[model samples]
Target: MKNLLESPPDKLLTALRDILAAKSIVSPAEIAERIALTDAASPAQGARMVARAWTDPDYRALMLHDGAKAAEAAGIPMRGMPPLGVLADTPDLHHLVVCTLCSCYPRAVLGYPPFWFKSAAYRARAVRDPRGLLAEWGTVLPSHMKLTVVDSTADYRWMVLPLRPAGTEGFTEAQLAALVREGDMIGVTLPIASA
Candidate 1:
């Protein structure tokens, strides 16, 4: 038959899909929609949430409690994606995120992973020596402060909520958001106030 002569990978994929559906694991339609959503997600969506949290204490608490619900409330598409875990950086503690197994980042919130994020070196270094890595990135924490490295996995993704910079008490939400960078959300860098 024509199907028999088709590529083995396609046949394998079809078989896998059928097995998954038969086992009631995940439907093929859901998978397709997830792929579409991933493609549609952008870093700007995450920046908006950060800006809102910076300005709204209630929203910040909600975000820290249930990141998925907060992100949905912010109008970011997360219909079929895994729940996002937001790690907030404080004066005495800092959070860093990395995917040791692979580049399992919060793509729906922070867009595509950077080149270094997917590199083997970064994956190993993040868990091994987070302070050193942060230092290399020009983020030197206080000697008494603590650094926490969080690992992201396939089923769950993580993002960082950087501390709002000082002397910007009057900055509007849009202006605050403009200062947020993709790296800041990923915990690789901090957001600096623009003059």
Candidate 2:
């Protein structure tokens, strides 16, 4: 038999699937459905939610109160996923998210965690020197603002609702979404008015 550990990921997954099937632990159809769901997710889904929240007061309140519901309302699937928490940024405060233990992220909304988000250096620096880390990402905030580092875990994941940029008051939801990036939602960067 080929060594499973040395096999390519595709072969390894096939082998595991065969074993699980033999044991009747899970069905192939279920696995395929999950893979399809994951593949369908992308950062655009999160951007849509952010854009809606930016333009609608009711949506903003709903998002701050229950993030998972807000995401579902925005057309992102939340079933079989952990609860999502949104940290709203304001003039006086900023929020940064990190999974100190592992990369427990809101994949259903944001698609996937960035490589840097899973690095040991990032995890350490995020908690140790958040200001410096943000500065490195060109997200330097004012000295008077409060910066809070929120940890995402298996039980819950966190996303940021960045403050809307000025001079975008007349922008449509789609236009506003165009201005949002994954980094902005991750709190590593801010969304600019000029997309």
Point to the candidate with the largest lDDT.
Answer: 2
- The runs of at least 3 residues in candidate 2 whose Cα sits more than 4 Å from the true structure, single-residue gaps closed, are 1-3, 6-12, 19-24
lDDT string, candidate 1, 1-195, tens digits: 457557598877898899999999999998797877778788888899999999999999999998899999998887767889999999988889999998998887888888999999999999999989988999888899888899886688899999998877899999999899888888878899972
Model number with the top TM-score: 2
- Residue 39's lDDT within candidate 2 is 94
What are the Cα lDDT values of the candidates? Answer: 0.89, 0.92
- List clashing residue pairs in candidate 1: none
The stretch of ten residues in a row with the least summed lDDT in candidate 2 is: 2-11
TM-scores vs. true structure, each candidate: 0.81, 0.91
